[model samples]
Target: MIMDANTIKDELKKVGISINDIYDLVNTKESYPLAIPVLLDLLQKGIEDVKIKEGIIRALAVKEAIGKASPILIEEYHKIAKDKMMLRWAIGNTIYVTITENDVDSILQIVQDDENGMSRQMFVLALGKVKSEKAEDILIKLLDDEELTPHALEALGRLKSKKAKSKIEILTKHPKSLIKKEAEKALKKIG
Candidate 1:
């Protein structure tokens, strides 16, 4: 069924139709286009529900509505300081969808402030999606972090950085098989 934003909003008001159900529907390509505008509207209303906010963010990313969603996501990021994982994932998805130079500094700041390894890893991967020299430098620095190195290497590979080639080669002999495999793949990508 082809639903407009108003119709979707009404459906959401129904008691049993939870946000997760909306999320599942919006995750599909056919439904995402219809869902994104409504999701953005809900976000704009300042919905306090964390799950709803996350669902909206994911819907925006899945629909590739970065241009329309980035500003709102950044605003939400600034407002949400306690939910580190959610913020990181939303930012990562935003970066992945739209690798703009304007967002690089903010993303770097988030990476610097976050102490969680997984959040840092997600942010590092997001940084790789940015096609800026600054992002490349940040990825290089993260290569020394044992916990983040594998993800960093993967991001560098995605960025296709020739400067990371030597370092990635060194990681090919890492004791951890996952790191070794990722490093080998990164080397190939760099080449």
Candidate 2:
């Protein structure tokens, strides 16, 4: 059964997402088997409420939603300029879970922008899911990023990036135990 706007809103409310409007629900006649595109369209149309947008983004994090939502989510990630922690984390988590090889370039673009801060943390780690040499190089350079160094180490290890082995080695003795732990884990993976 196709859910109407009110039904969608009610469902969202049930999950603690109390929103006033259902911004652009898909047409009832459309053949979309899933609600992913409807949610992605709202995100693309620029929902102003961070919480609502975050809810939609998180809802679309499922594996079935990846091909349809990844590009739109990346677009939304770029659109966010403020330091909204929950929203940023939501996007990062969604992208991290759904990220594909095709999304690597865009993820790299976002990760390279230091202004995005730790919001890019999950994106850094998501790079591990793709085995691109570009991803490996970027992860290596990200070793210099204090906030993302641990995630970078983890991603390189996921890639089993022999190229990054030396950089990962340097972090093994990092002052932060978390960094040291990740560095060791990454080295084990690389080996």
* Model 2, C-alpha of 136: deviation from truth (Å): 0.4
**Compared with the true structure, what per-residue lDDT tens digits does model 1 show for residues 21-88?**
54665466453454556566677767555665666666677535755666667667667655467555
Root-mean-square deviation (CA) per prediction: 5.3, 6.5
User: Candidates' TM-scores?
Assistant: 0.77, 0.82
Native-referenced Cα lDDT, model 1 = 0.70
C-alpha lDDT (0 to 100) for residue 157 of candidate 2: 86
Using TM-score as the measure, the top candidate is 2
Model 2 TM-score, all chains together: 0.82
- Which lDDT values do the candidates have, in the order given? 0.70, 0.78
Task: Give the winner by lDDT.
Answer: 2
List clash counts for every candidate, in order: 0, 0
